[model samples]
Target chain A: MDFDIKRLGFTLLGLLIVLNWGLLMSSIMRKLGARVAKRYGIRWFQPWLDLVKNYALRSQISHGIMFYLGPVFRIGGGVGLFLFMPMIIGSELWLNYSFHGDLVLLMYFQFFGMLGMALGSGEGGHPYSAIGISRGLSQFTTIEVPMTLAIISLAIQYDTLSLIDIVKAQQGGFQNWTMWTNPVATIAGMFSLLGALSHSPFNLVKAPNEIPIGPPTEYHSTFLGVLQTNAAILHVVEAALFMNLFFGGATNWFEFILKTFFIYFWSVFVGVVFPRFRIEQSVAWFLKIPLVFGVLAIILYM
Target chain B: MSETKNNNKFENPHYAKREVTGPDGKQFIVDPIKDYFSDERPKVYEPNSIPVVEKFLNWARAESLWVLGFGTGCGSIEIPPLMTPRFDAFRFGIQSRPTPRQSNVFIISGYLAVKTLKRVIRSYEQMPSPKYVLALGSCTINGGMYFDSYNTINRLDHYIPVDVYVAGCMPRPEALLAAFNRLKELIKEGKGEKANEYAANFDWYKENQKKIIKDWNMPDYNW
Candidate 1:
């Protein structure tokens, strides 16, 4: 089947990079806030966290339409990825579009999910919701710069933007999945994962104690119910994306699920171990250190 | 007797004769004399539509009163317990609705903030017809805590028509219950004539609502 590479590229890019990555990152940061509060013997933050996690729990019937629509948009974006991402091990017949998967495409598509969430939050019309959106956007802005540099360096190293080509270029052994290819690139990848998950030391968007549930303060009823579901599913998507990019696509379906979940647990473990960062501190830290890793990788490639 | 026997035999097969029984364990023969005087006679099918009495009762039952949660001051804090597990005001057909569209009673809990007064007035206006304003806590009655302040509406009656005034800086829960009982009694007594009068004068109420909203520099309506 003849595939318009640009259209397919944009679609896949929109799904993985735009939609899933943004939500996965923000949700992890939000979950981290709840976890940290529980660990500190602070029960007061429970209601606050519940408020974020269950934004649509108590929504009025009049506003139910909007609340319900938010999650549909979110889940739809996630499902869109399954159709768009190219199958490496499976037959190409399953894919209507065949092209080398561009690393840049993956990065841009990651923001689609974030856009959906921000729009949903905006519709809820709560001050805290707006605040969360602003903070989340700020964090995205800070980390994305270094994340792009790292991806570009990987693309340059393989001399191709297609993710499939990048993985095929490293086909000799398991260590060839790019992380073990260079230590600096690996550190940059790990830090980028940290950024994508919005793990602690970078999770300023949904801070409970300060923001009173942040963007989800006013959401209730089915609206909140869907957001929780979106959060869980989006986690798997993020892990899958990370695994697909850094580790080669699995040879089998079982291995694919397993590898993605392993990455998810690793990300969660990192989230659990760290404390949160203030907006300025998060920006400063990601840019100064992890950014250096990306630069070094690029220089090494050159 | 021979003619009657012939008539019975000639009767149409389409007609079936039904036997009647009595509580006395005997078959009841239709004797005209006994049947004419029987109290167990079928009711005459006069248009026995819904009775006025029953209709009135049903209307009263369905006109379930709802209270608005427009608490103004310290007394506002006490409303949670009255609403929740301990008091459970929902049993009385009086549940709290945040907006006025569904509420009948605007229970002004206490001292109305200048800011809050504007909101209260708007809420009262937004409430559909047959609405009553209940000024709880003495602050709403005569501005108990803040009588001197020009910003405070000393007499709630001056701003919006109030039906009941419950006294105390913070009226005890019992006092609120008593006031609620009185409201129910007033409802039962059909003293809603005043509520109807206020609702009819929509322009005057709207003007007052606008004045409050304008004073606060908020829009006349949230929309």
Candidate 2:
């Protein structure tokens, strides 16, 4: 009902923890992947990661600066998203707020963090970094429409632009969660998340086998450490946000974390198993599915 | 943390020793560990009464020029096998990096066409100090093929001073090795500064690089 600065600060701190958690998870995932590669004698994977790390993080000062800046901008965008969208912290009386400005705001705001990273990488003056940024921006064009459709679906379901109101309306748990109620929309969201995370099958941005970890290739030192940390943290944030939107928040903190982790694990598992999609295929795939879902969500809501 | 952990677990198997057919074609055990431990840890060069052999070794180590993967010409293709197991340039402490930031050597492999020449200059400028350049072929030394094309610069050394010029349309890999040895010799004789002085004409190099890119209306790789 009321915005408290202290409460908001606490929430921001929790957000920081979530970001750090994402950074750690990404590192763990890479390490785990490398270890598996080593066991299988797939020698290239570990060395590949090491080379990228050295090129991007261990090389010099300029790269170091860009690497650290990546996460800060990412967190900034996350903060902005959390501020605008619906979030329900189930502490009985802790807080609940939702406001919808416009679909444009939510959609374009996502680009800020990504764009900042691209710019930072470009300034490092590495060809690979430039190549990566170009690929990343191009991928955006493909996923944006489908994701927008999903957003529109939610917008229609509540007949209001505010995300908080949507969550409040969908409070009846599993049956009320958008995915269960509207499977098409839920599936569309999953596909979009796949694109957003740059996960396997859609992982064009950091495709090691191709672009040599792209923009981060020139980053080094404390800067790269920060970027890597932020990457994992952003993953956690994205996963949590997805869970909050589509799956009911747990009645307790334990349940909440467990449910979120459950989703996170599934996402990671699916992500690791799938091979990366070519840029064109990813674009075409997202364009069709989410657009259809968007039309369906609109019709169903109407 | 993960890098260190993995680095510790993995012993750079690429650098490990195994049985290899010697020049006599007889199988001989080559133990890198034995070779590593057999010698006293090689120290950095000190301008003192170090033994001649030790001095030579240090000079070799210092000029063990690791190249960056900023390929600018047809000559760039030669780099792959040079670093592969057969050639194993790493024996000289020279490794190929994918980024220019970390490399101490810019092997301007061959002719710098107006198109790729801009990138070559940018890469050259990005490399840290105490760097050396090896003009790999006649094209890199004096634009052998495209000498009158106006698209290729006739003398790269006029732009970025070369320490050793390996002559050939495309110099054989052996020539590259020879050029490297020559660079080591020059370094031993305190001629490393000569390369740096030539490279230090930042203004002239920038102008020449700009003319190459602009006169030919060449597009950057991504652009």
Candidate 3:
């Protein structure tokens, strides 16, 4: 357990690169969506401007200390995921602090932000925050069932719990990737990714029209800017996790960007094609189709 | 002015004072107006002393005007078209936000009835400082056809500070876009300090609001 300052610096640098990439990818996706609807999209630099504007807001009101810590915990979760996730498979510098059993830790980090948001938004005392937390937690719980089942299938297939090892196992060729060798588990994992990403069809938690932007309804100013920052980092990190587990991790920055973009796009592609589901319908939908694939994945491994 | 009537019929019970038992079995008086809401007065935040920093922030603010999507009147129909392909206000960084806390621009579209004015005032106060109001339509200017009506207010600026006005019976989406551009120009010029103006004239604005609102169940300042 030797701690090195250089390693820490590289990890922080890696996080920065991922954050910028995430912002660019989001704006690009938004532009694509706008084009689809026959409308001009926001400028590519819009997200950066919004981030600045939110932080530049002169006034801020707080409900409690937890309200302040909410965004802190959320960004902590995003950073925690990055800390243990190996970005480029064969690169020693970008491997971060990933160790044996990091896969399990990554799973826990995925849900960490939501729980923190629940506590923070609950303290805000906005009724919509409560409704959103309930829906988000329930939907996220169901999403985890399929995702965890797929991971279990992968663990059984590779006989390891480390993401680095999992990525290593898939290296050499595309045929060796879990998407080919363990298609059932990949399907289950990919299906849950749509929910995990919280895009249109599964976006009831923050149903802007219905719930008035949900959990962060009361979050404003620098608080909201932090959430937006975490959102950018989290999206890319989540895609990176999937990239490592299923797509045979990247050996370089270019490969990393290309793979993560397509992985993130999978959910966005599904989102635009489908209409939203109610909380009940979404929870039930995840339990049915993705759950079945998850079970089938596990059974295949057994 | 006539004696202000206590409009008990319109008073919301949830906002009324009552006793509540906490989870620990402790009883406490709960006055929603005083206990649930922040009573702090809005303060005027002076611009940054450094010219470069202030100018940069103003530029960012101008480029990203998150409009509160609460349409007050008939001019609301004009807003939806701004999001459509024909207008597409997104390209100009004029996006709609669902909540007041996140938005800096409040569009007082069309005429403001006394009833909707209360909600508008609350939403306006809740917005963070350096906020701007884009009063749309002749309804907001002089009540348009509603000038003789018993309920609608003739001038919106009497109740809330308005930064830009788009004059029309109901301004078309193109006109609204022009108003947004004007608002952005004002913001970039560091002239969008109407939120501070409302704070400076707090008593006068509150008196004007209370004169028409009647019930006045909520606090003077919504924060």
**TM-score for each model:** 0.49, 0.53, 0.97
lDDT of 2 by residue, B1-223 (tens): 0111123333455345566767777777665445332222211223336567545533543534557777677777888767655565644545565656556678887778766766675566555444678887888766787888867888887667677888898877777777777887776675665434643454575566555554422222111
lDDT (tens digit, per residue) of candidate 1 on A166-246: 656666668777767766776787787777766455656755445655666554434554565566555656666666667
Q: Which structure is stronger by TM-score: 1 or 3?
A: 3
User: By summed lDDT, which 10 consecutive residues of candidate 3 chain B come out lowest?
Assistant: B1-10
Cα misplacement distance, residue A187 of candidate 2 (Å): 0.9
Better of 1 and 2 by TM-score: 2
Provide the lowest-lDDT 10-residue window in model 3 chain A: A96-105
True contacts kept of each: 0.00, 0.05, 0.89
Q: Which candidate leads the pack in TM-score?
A: 3
lDDT of 1 by residue, B92-113 (tens): 5455654454456788888876
Q: Each model's C-alpha lDDT?
A: 0.60, 0.61, 0.91
Worst 10 residues of 1 chain A by lDDT: A50-59
Q: Write the per-residue lDDT of candidate 3 for residues B31-68, one digit (tens) a residue.
A: 77788887777788899899899999999999999999
Q: What is the Cα-based lDDT of residue A267 in candidate 1? A: 61
